[model samples]
Target: MSKSSHRDPLSDTQLRVKALESVLLEKGVVKQETLDAIIDNYENKVGPHIGASVVAKAWTDPDFKSRLLENASDTLAEMGLSGIEGTHVEVKENTAELHNMVVCTLCSCYPWTLLGLPPTWYKSTPYRARAVRDPRGILAEFGVKMSENVEVRVWDSNAEIRYLVLPIRPAGSEGLGEDELAELVTRDSMIGTAVVEMN
Candidate 1:
């Protein structure tokens, strides 16, 4: 078969980012070493695992969970997990009666320190518009099926604050330790696009 002519949009986006980086370097707007260090930090040093650790702690400790729900920014900062785009964070917990999802309707304002970077879908115009219009449909697309009895709440993130979803602790997780539970928590789950499954 001949190679397809269609190009991947993500590849195109990566190329654009590279071009922008090159232009910035040429203009001396940013140093290559600075860019490299920032990339290294996001790629190797920081990611969703930090948020996963917090979720695991909340799962294991009721007191911490209570505090997290009451005041997310302070609670998260207490663990030294605060930074730009994370200064104001609100956490919503998933329960039997309600499911929480986060979306930046205005733009892709997200908790980068905790969630790494927003997924391309999260930053798309369609997702921003549809998530609020038809959350259940969006959830279904994300492979999350919910009963009619459960309420779906879609929170709009903005410049003032960002949201995180505290996914429900899955069944059969009682035997797991904090570290093990953290492994089960995924970036999508925390974003409310998916849930944590035992498998």
Candidate 2:
């Protein structure tokens, strides 16, 4: 497979982020190490866990789930996971009959507050165009096989509003606690590309 667009061809958002980081470094607002740590934290530690926790709570708590479904931007504040340019968020459900996929056709507009940074593939033009045109095909490429009856729903992310997919919890997970459930939620699942594996 070819390398990510980062090295071969940088996306606009990537360039902007780099420019901002450079300005901040020049002003001494943050050290290079600090910036690197923050990126590492988002890429590995904190970001995706926030979204996973939301999904896990939705799985366990019906009231929060309802509130989340109704207004994620506000409901997320209750969990202290709001802010960071997340003024609007739309939560979509992936059920037995419906499947959801997220893409940003223009830029890498995503729920950065909850999901951290978008993956390199998410910023690719090919992925952006292909996701909306053939969501099931993209899902299959991601190893998400679905039955023919499942209707695929693709949501194009933008700067003002972003989408998060609440994937269907696997069977036999009824006994799992909130933390255990959160552990099962992956970044791709919330992106609607893959389902949460029970194991």
Candidate 3:
């Protein structure tokens, strides 16, 4: 049968998508598990693991945090993690009187090194809409109740650069080391949904 005359099982986009899917499926099958294993391998093993490391380093090393705040790309590369989109990352610190929240108003632009994969809610229309309109209320839903006087500044990550929130370190974590501090920097803390609190 002529190519044009035959029914194509896949369109151009479908062909590309299927090709990637097949590779991922094969990788998972070879690893003797479901696709989730492969995803977990990347999420837990490779992707954004560097970001967690960076957060840890920043927590301990003041010099590194200064460098990261000055220029994220250089600092990240210095730590041997680079090449993701949004190499231009801006770190915003949340203080007691001022809180900062990050959202990709146009799309889900995030610093993957520090944030790993974007959560479903991060990309949802409801979050995108509500984050800008009722940021405090949205944060409240996640159990982060800010003081009435605290100003909430919502940042919209655009095409140029991505954002990572530096949440205020918990009070009791005064003597914590880098490793301990990293554990406190939850994804919610970075996203401004919750604050980092010591138990």
Candidate 4:
């Protein structure tokens, strides 16, 4: 028989689990339960909250915002978030001169450090394809109407650099603290589908 004929017939999920198990077994370092716990801890407790903090700090500190604009990965490390996507991150700012939007296009390649697991819409194939072609129309469907003059530039995230949107700070937040400001920075804002509005 040929080498291909001798291969196993496991499904994709089964193959992934078997591959992970093989690696863990080879390492002989930790139990499956322990590895599961580590994954759970990072996903639930560490990643999203760290990202929120960074957004909050940027809202409150102009200097930090400058640094983030210059070198996002290094600025993120200054806030104790390193090793995210191999120390590489890119910050895209949304402005009237040039609005920025992000979509995985291929898959949900997100910056989990500042924004946890991606939302359902982000992973949808429709969003990936439509976001780049008609950004303003997509945003309008999400109830965001933009001026006709504002140009929208959609970014497709790949294996190398992850993209995050720096939303324009809302008005009437002149006296808000960092924690309060962070609450305004929602996932939609980062995705450039919704703008934060102050009451």
Candidate 5:
């Protein structure tokens, strides 16, 4: 078969990365099981769970909440959450009057350590543009409706920094423990795209 007639399974750059990974694996510099473990962690244990843990701690601990609001990245590190994409995190608290949202105008720079990979819509150009131009409309599209009196704040994520929304604790959740509170937190809430459901 002609080379041109068959599409390559991997892109040239992707193939190069794979080749490098293979070499490292063969040399025992990187174990296959370790690689699989890392993937499994990101696919399951990491992502919103980490963010939710942080949020729940803040909701349940006043001092920790103050520390998180004052210096988020350091606080995250204390919790064993840090990565290239999450080297810096800034928490934006959602209040009765102000609602926060995040967008990456340049690219899909995100808190991968806390949210796994960026969602497709979040990485799209339309989201980047529309979020800055019409945040309320975007929120509405996500089924997040707020009164006109509420203000919408849009944050831009870049290589240097990322944003996480500290959603308001539901009124009925006051008796909940940190773990229970964490259960109430959601990926969308961490991304400022939706509110954490109380129930």
Candidate 6:
């Protein structure tokens, strides 16, 4: 077989990305070590679990919850969770009457260290527009039917700051431990797309 036939197939976009990466590496614009570190950070070191831990702690500890609400950056730093994309973080709490959701109207400026990579929908133009324009509709589509009496607040994340939603603890979960509570926290809940359910 010829070299072309032997080569693995790659999509046009993938090939372009690989070509650009090769050119950058050849030009010394980026170091292999840096690239490896970034991949490793996203693949292993970072994820929604980090944010879930903080949420669990907040759920179990009143003081921690207060600190998280009052100063999320400082509180996250205390847990050694501070880094790029997390320098300026804000935590919004969900209560009986108040509901909060976060969206990046400009771009997907998310808390990468806490939430890993942003979801494809989060970066889409439709989501960016609808999140601010019709948050209740979006929530309803996600199966969250908010009562008419409940207030809905939509937060726009930007380059300067990112928002994390502190979803209300599920009923019958009061007896759960921190780790168990963390298990209950989902990435969508933190993004305010879905509420945490015990089941």
Q: In candidate 4, what are the lDDT values of residues 61-101, reduced to their tens digit? A: 89998899999988888766766552688888877777778
Ranked by lDDT, the better of candidates 5 and 6 is 6
TM-scores, all candidates, are: 0.86, 0.80, 0.77, 0.80, 0.83, 0.91
Q: Give the C-alpha miss distance for residue 21 in model 1, angstroms.
A: 5.0
Backbone clash count, each prediction separately? 0, 0, 1, 1, 0, 0
- Per-residue lDDT of candidate 6, residues 1-199 (tens digit): 7765766666467877899999999999999999999999998889999999889999999998999999999989878888888888999999999999999998788988789888899899999999999999999999999999999999998668878999999999988999999999999899998999997
Provide the RMSD of all predictions against the true structure, rounded to 1 decimal: 5.9, 6.4, 5.9, 3.6, 3.6, 5.0
Candidate number of the best lDDT? 6
Task: Please give the range of 10 consecutive residues that has the lowest summed lDDT in model 1.
Answer: 1-10
All candidates' lDDT scores?
A: 0.90, 0.87, 0.77, 0.78, 0.88, 0.91
lDDT of 1 by residue, 1-199 (tens): 5433566655678778888988999999999899789889778877899889989999999999999999999998988888878988999999999999999998899898788888799999999999898999988988999889999998988667888899999999999999999999999999998999996
Q: Once superposed on the true structure, which residue ranges of model 5 sit more than 4 Å away at CA?
A: 1-34
| Candidates, ranked, TM-score | 6, 1, 5, 4, 2, 3
* TM-score winner: 6
Per-residue lDDT over 80-116 for candidate 3, one digit per residue giving the tens place of the 0 to 100 score: 6655654788887788788999898888887775677
**Per-residue alpha-carbon lDDT of model 2 for 1-199, expressed as tens digits?**
5545445454577777888888998999989898788778677865788899899999999998999999998888766776655668889988899999899998888888788888899899889889889888888899988889999988887568888999999999999999999999999999999999888
Angstrom error of the Cα, residue 33, model 2: value is: 10
Clashing residue pairs, candidate 5?
none
lDDT of 1 at 63: 98
In model 4, residue pairs whose N, Cα or C atoms come closer than 3 Å (at least 3 residues apart or on different chains), thus clashing, are 51-114
Candidate 5 C-alpha lDDT tens digits along 60-127: 89999999999999988988888868888899999999988888988888888888887899988889
Runs in model 6 lying further than 4 Å from the true structure = 1-11
Cα error of candidate 3 at position 166, Å: 0.9
**lDDT score of residue 170 within candidate 2:** 92
